[model samples]
Target chain A: MAEIARLAGVDTSTVSRALAGSPRVTKETRALIDKIVHETGYVVNETARHLRGGRANQILVIVSDIAAPFYSDVVQGIVETLAERGINVLLGVTLRQAKREAQLAKQLLTGVVDGIITVTGSIPKPVLSMPGFERKVLAISRAVPHEGVTCVTIDNCAATRQVMQHLHQRGHRRIVYIGGPNYSETYRDRRGAYADFMRENGLAELARMRATDSFNDDADSGFHIMKSILNEGDRPTAVFCATDELAIGAMAAARQADQIIPRDISFFGFDDLKLTPLMSPPLSTVSVPRFEMGRRGAEALFRQVYKDAPSSSKVVLDHRLILRDSVATIV
Target chain B: MAEIARLAGVDTSTVSRALAGSPRVTKETRALIDKIVHETGYVVNETARHLRGGRANQILVIVSDIAAPFYSDVVQGIVETLAERGINVLLGVTLRQAKREAQLAKQLLTGVVDGIITVTGSIPKPVLSMPGFERKVLAISRAVPHEGVTCVTIDNCAATRQVMQHLHQRGHRRIVYIGGPNYSETYRDRRGAYADFMRENGLAELARMRATDSFNDDADSGFHIMKSILNEGDRPTAVFCATDELAIGAMAAARQADQIIPRDISFFGFDDLKLTPLMSPPLSTVSVPRFEMGRRGAEALFRQVYKDAPSSSKVVLDHRLILRDSVATIV
Candidate 1:
């Protein structure tokens, strides 16, 4: 490091900043440092630096499933946000498996990564017992029960209440709530809000709900669940799904049963997916700021990892109810 | 290691294998080794191992866009395949930006990862010149021009030919081709094949094509392009899109223009996305084994990385043209 600084006629700190791609160095000085480093082949030994207890410059972004449409934007946000800071992201998919989550948590605690940003909602229990884990963990989308980890999420209860109120205002007396797995805190909160609203509004008798099997909230699950509802001969005025995938699947099943959307049944979904607007009737959904959630989660994790910020902060972003053509104004 | 093995009354190699989660160790012995390690607070020194020029056991999976819908299944396959081997996956999204790809390539070459598997189609030039890069790089869905990296992709020419022939067999003369960005080798190959089939069938005059702008192949792009085509008063009997998103978008535009699917125009798309089956008319697309492509690509890279296998192999997987409600059998 001193040799590079002497050759570049700059302070060692400037050389270090330049090497780390810090913006503090001017463009000309950065060019000079790059030239010198290229000529001297002074490769930064990341493994050696990590052995010396320096930052690995990498963090693990763990998700339950990458193939889920909901996560792609969120993961993209984290990757892009962190890349700007010259920090690489290691993606670990748990597939909602306990063993896999435990394995990945071991890697995070064992120094393979600088910290962990879990979008999977729940952190492994064993990870909580690790020393200094509080300083290196952040949760997104779902709040962690532990006081050590910070969480970034939208107000699920508020979002659900808004959806239910909208349905009630539209004169949808019988609204069925099709929830995802109970393991997800987001789903639990939404379901809780739905129950609370129904009871408070004296519509408890019309409060019917069904949930997809654990770890299975995809469109197919929604299709089968909706099929069962249709077969039971109890038609609801509206269906509120925990996810857009579920709503889309329920819509498909309704179409198969010759039920016209909005005319026969209204539908509402969470997570305004990119393809939602392109749907036939343009799905009415709660537009949760997924990308912003990911970006803020990364930023929060960065603050905790580098700036010594408190790790127990909770950040609640804004969400909007997007009423598209899928919902009907019933009298 | 010696203490763990001595305490467990096992060989050091057994202890190492057990620690590495190798399947060769019996369940009883593995449990014993885990107990000893837990009691002794033993943690694997990944950094020290890498400093000794050992395997990092982590590979980078680079993609152009994570939200493209095309990549989620592929990435899932890669993650699952590697996780079974106790290897970790680090995801790097280049977002089709040249600088980001170059930066990620630098990380791969600088020993931060054991190897790299690029689904981005094009590998950075500097990475091609890196020593031993041949043994550490694999390409999926798109072939790298360099001879060093093995590639796993479907035969684009054959797939496109099948789509064109199927359209022709259905007595469609004016089948317009809707392609994606030209930067993608897969898109280029598909377009080239479409041209070849048109000329060979002596329908050159009927061969009209349109493409989305560079790095813009999402549904919105398809919608705008279709709208322009409609404005131009060029009504083709059918449209063959390079991706499912494009097809879905085009279909939406057609619906907006009050054109009934199949009855007014037929549509065909590549990459049978999960939501395709739920479309009102159900999209007819070519089924490219995306998960298999990812799985095979990772396995090929694993062979080169671990077994010193040759890295210049080309593995072409099969593709099927699915005929659903989107296409019409016109007389």
Candidate 2:
């Protein structure tokens, strides 16, 4: 940057601004700076410019699956922000498989990517337990439980608490919680929140209604679980699902059983998937800023790589309550 | 090959068999070959050993949306097959954006991946018109009217003919066809088949309902077009959606309008999405063997990359009609 600035008869800041194609820079100056860059093969220190690693120009954004509905917008956000700094993204999909996650971790050891931001928690615990793993790995919307590794996740516990509050306020004494497996940070937080909140609210009787791994991230799981719940004599006035996929599944089951959403039984869900709006009665969900989460995860990884900054700062993007028709105001 | 055979005290064929992990090769021989490979870093020319790509150990799988539901299984198939050969995959998601596609095309010029297989026709016509692009690209579930490009697609025309035959034989005179953009080969063939098959069957009156984008691909476009058809008088007794997402949107609209699926009217959909079987009444649709399409697409690309074989021959994978409750017997 300093060399380019000297050649262009401009300050280093102006050179930086020009190279970034900043709107503040004059078009002619930007073009001139670009020409000089091409002529000299000037490779910018993208990491330093972005304040991540001192100059490592690379970040690995790991998602469990590229095709899964939960992570596309987040990946899109990460790619968009990184593209400006000439930092390339290498995507790794773990497929929720432990072996694949281990292989990806081994591949990362090759020094191909400067830092890794993983959304999947499928990696073996022993790998993270190994020394020399600090400052290089970050979790996104998932937890690794390591001291040096940071995370950018929604307030899942509070979100679950809010759902219980919503149901309780709506005059629902019995509320069922349908959740995924215990291995995931997402599922753990949600289940813990449900148990704690229900007990705190004096709705201890509702705790027994909770179902685990009832929705293996699928609608059919929700359907079967809902059927089993409805088949029992006592029924909850409202149900809260861990993710929107489970919510949709439960919704399908309710409809199949000739029950109407919010009329007979209110329902709540999380991770407001795009299709949630299109469901028969738009789902009431905790709208996770997945795009922002992805963008921040990418930015954080880049920041650690470019600036050698602190690696322990956890950033929580906002999640909003979308009060769609599915949540009945019974009170 | 000779080196491996000499080192292992085995014939060249035995060495090859052990490396290929053929059942005929004893476990001891396979273990011996593996140890030698570990010692020598002996890279397998997967293409040649498989009698496909003699030396190409890289495969490129391009998707319209790396996150879309449509391409997930296809990618899984490609990854599983290629991983078995110790082949590396370079995944490029175009996001259905033309500018990005052009940029990715330039990167493709670097000869990084051994073979290129795209889910749809992503590269612009002008981009493909450029020299040196003729021999490498293959279209999966799509057709490109270009020489040298291999196409691995489902028999869309025949499949559509079967759909129309099923609907017509069910005593339904009026039929509707909802499709996608004009550039998509899958949509084009389905629409063309709808028209030709309708004309041949003397159902010209119902052939008036055809929808397509001017120059872009979007499922919402299909939903709006289907809405217009529904609003008009004398609605079709049966409807055929080119893809499942479009069908889903159409179904939502029908549900909103109090029209019961297959009870008030019949609907046939394509691409049997994972969510389809879980949909209310389970969508009556044709299931395209996407995994096979992807596996074969990579297989064809490797064949070209290693042997310099001209694979202009289009391969058609299987498509089966799943008789779910969505399409009622109209008698």
Candidate 3:
């Protein structure tokens, strides 16, 4: 550190502040220090620095699947928001495995990361029980149901109710709900809301299908479920899917089965993915504030980690019902 | 460690091996040690362990964007492959910013990670010039052009030639090529191949369009570029895009202009994304083995970091041309 300071003609404290990305260090000084540090091949031992009680200034962002399009926008939001604050994000994809999630939780408790922002909707049980876990953990997209972990999520039930109301108003009585696994609180709420809306509207006899395999909820799963339903000749006027990927797959299956979209069956989906707008008839789905959820989640986590704020707050962002060409009125 | 071993009725080395996820540790003993560790709230300080000359067992995977969808499958492959070896993945998204890329490269040098696998194609100059960097760095998807960095990539030129030959065989004389930024060697190779093939086939007069804004190469960019071309009254018989996202967007623009796919204009794309098969016309694209690229990249990186092998080798994966409904047998 002193060598870098001498090379950059700055004090050792100034060199430290620059390396820490502190705002107190002017841009010119930071640049000089960075140049000197790079030129001198001075590798900062982050592990040693953290061992000496300095902040890691790094957070672990955990998600269920990295390939799932749903988490991408949210993660982009988190990475961008945290980057502006000079924090590095270390992403961990659990692939929906419980053991992997536990391993990651242990890593968090081991102090490699200063905090964790989990978009997987659930925190490991051991992590929740750890002392000070609340202060260093935040959840997004689904509520963790724990009292201490701050969550940034949308009202999935309300979003589902809006979809149901739209379909109901369009004179659709025979609507089939295809959902993902019920392990996710978000999926569970959506399914529950659909059931409630149907029962209250005197349309409770409609059949429902859910992804039996907990590990599969993507487009392929949606396609197979829709194909089987079509094969059984149980064609409803409309199909409501838990996700846009599922909806896309369902549409493909319907096409393969010689069913025309909107004319033969209307499709509604959740989590209005980017591909939704470019679909054949375009998908009528819920527009989730995924990026906002991530941004807000990171901000909330930062508050807890840096400001010593309470970690029990819940922030629900707004969602919109995007009615596109996929839904058609039926008399 | 001693306390845990005492509680689990095992030696300290057994506990250590179990914690390190060594193959020598029996599953039953590992489970017992894990249970005791969790029950006793024993936090394994990874930072301290690394400082004591132990392996970090973590690698950093860097990409340009997380939401682009192009990197998702590749990242999944890397994560799964590394996880099997008990190595954790720390993903860093640079968002295509050079400054951010430099920052991430600096992080790798700081000893927070054992090695780095960059999917972003180019490594920062400082990182490359650092002593012994060759033993700890790997590139994927695009060749780094640096001597010592092992690259796992596909023959973009060959893939483009296959697409071109397929189009030529289908009697499509007028084809347009739309590509991403030239900063990427992958895109550059694809573009170069298109030019060479067009000239070789005596079709040099065909027009070409590329995304001028280096940062924007997604669906929206494709849509705008295609829309502009349509507005200018340049209706090529076929359009080939560098990526599936771009092709999807181009198809949407054609649809908006009331152009029926394949019947009015044919469309072809590269990178057979999971969403490709679900598109309205089921886009015909080059199926680059993205997952295998990732898997191979991770394996090569492991060899360099663990086995102390040379890092100058290049692994070129195969690409397949998928025939789907989007392209027509035009006369």
Candidate 4:
């Protein structure tokens, strides 16, 4: 550090600030220091720094599927929130698999990181219930049975009911519920809400399709399931999916089968993901506060880690229905 | 561990395996073991483990943007590849800021992890040129000037030429190139190729739209730029964007302007990111081997880290032009 400082004609602290990417130093000064360090082959010895500082200055953020746009927004929120506090982000993706989720949780529980924010529904229940784990954990957009862990989620039932009522008002007589596995709490709550909405409105909930992977991360299952519905059974006037991923698949299948969107059958999705608006006929879906959920999850986790506050609590954010070109008036 | 095992009537190895989420034991056994550990108030003291083990057992993955589908697929590949070797991933987002990239590289260069895989075009040159860093770093889908850094990139010139040839053959004479920044090597290469293709084919290259951010991580720039082109005079018959994100924006702008696609204008994009098919008119794009690039970068990093291989190399993957509804023959 002193050598680079001497070469750049700056103080050691300026070099340190530059090395840490602190905006305190000008870019030109940093570049000069960087050039000196590059030429000198100087390294910071991060292992020694880790030894001196116990916290790792980093957090592990576990997401269900990195490829899914739905989770990426929340991950974005988490990354931005943590970066503000100078804490780095470690990413663990489970592909919505319980084993992978459990493995990630166990590593963190065993102490690789002091804190974790998990956004997967399939995490092993035992990992969540581990003693001392709650103080260092946050659940985002998913429910964990353990009492001490903080969580930020939306009311799935209420959101589903709103979607259902809107579809009913649009004169959709028959609606199919395309969802993931019964094991997923995320899907379970929404499915239950749909059933309740159907019974209350006197609408028959006869058609339901589960995407091939009980978890629905596979993007093509929605299309395949919808195709079968159109081919084998009485067609529902509308279909509501548990996620935008499945609905995208369903919409593609409809397009391939020459079933015009809304004109032939209306489609609805949860999670108004980034690409939903760009769909040929824009998709009408429920918009969950995904980024807010992530930001709040990080905020809650930081409170426990930095301020030593009580960790066990919950915050349910709001959801809105975004009606676009996908749905239509059916006579 | 012994006390928990004895209390649960299981061997200490069972407790160890369960806590590590080995999956050798049944979930029921794991749950029982977890209950015993929770009741016994046992914590695995991760600090001691990290200190004793001497390595963080994780790799840092620096991405251009976490929310973009293109980078996410590559990251997913890297995470999966590393997990197979029992290594974890630490994610750093540059947001296309050179300062942020420098700081991330400086941190990793100093030794937070034994290795880092960076997927960004805006990384500072000094960080890559820093001695001893290349032995522990891999660059994915971006060209770096440092000879020591191993990289996996597609042949941008060849891919762009194919796109230009296809559009020219489709009877489009005036084509607009919607690109990122002149400073960005990724776009510079493709732009150079487009200029070459235009000159060789006796076509004029007049329209060039740089996305709102020269760094191009923000996905909405293409739409904003395309809208301006629509409002102005002498519209090109076709537009080719550097990324699917930009093409998506361009398509939306065209739709809003009541400009029918293919008939009025043709659109082409690079990167066959998932969700391209679901577009109103499925996008025609150049499919870069994003996941493969990520996997190869990790492979290169691990080879150098674990096997003590050489530090520098390059691998150019194939690119495929996918023709879809976005473009059409114009007489």
**Candidate of highest lDDT:** 1
* Candidate 2 vs 3: which has more DockQ: 3
Q: Report, to 2 decimal places, the DockQ of model 4.
A: 0.42
Interface RMSD to the true structure, each candidate: 1.1, 9.3, 1.5, 2.8
Ranking by TM-score: 1, 3, 4, 2
For residues A14-124, could you state the per-residue lDDT of candidate 2 as single tens digits? 987887667999988888888997787565542243233223344666676665678766776776667655565655666677777666564344343556778875344
Better of 1 and 4 by DockQ: 1
Estimate, for each residue in B135-226, the C-alpha lDDT of model 3 and write its tens digit: 79899998887787789998899999999999999998788888889988888899999999999999988746566366788888888888
With a 3 Å backbone cut-off (N, CA, C), the pairs that clash in candidate 1 are none
Q: What would the per-residue lDDT of candidate 3 be over residues A1-331, giving only the tens digit for each residue?
A: 7888888888988988888889998888888889888778887677778778757777888998878888888988998889778777777888888898887776677777789999887888768777788889899997786777888988999999999999999999889998888988888998999999999998888746566367688998899999988987767999999999999999999998888899999999999998898888899999998888889999889989988888866888999999999998998
| lDDT (Cα atoms) of all candidates against the true structure | 0.88, 0.73, 0.86, 0.80
Q: Write candidate 1's Cα lDDT for B157-229 as tens digits.
A: 9999999999999988888899998878999999999999999999999998899987799999999888888
Estimate the lDDT of model 3: 0.86
- Candidate 4 TM-score over all chains jointly: 0.84
Instruction: Order candidates by lDDT, high to low.
Output: 1, 3, 4, 2
What is the clash count for each candidate, in the order shown? 0, 16, 0, 1
Q: After superposition, which runs of candidate 1 have C-alpha atoms over 4 Å from their true positions?
A: A1-36, A40-42, B1-36
Total clashing pairs in model 2: 16
Encode model 4's per-residue lDDT on B1-331: one tens digit a residue.
Answer: 7788898889988988899999799999999999987777587755455555666677888886788888888998899888888887888887777777777765566556667887775445545565577777788888766667788899999999899999988898889888877776788888888887877777745635454564553446788889898888788899998888888888888988888887899999999877777676788999988888888888888888878899767888888999899998987
Candidate 1 lDDT at A120 equals 80
Name the top TM-score candidate: 1
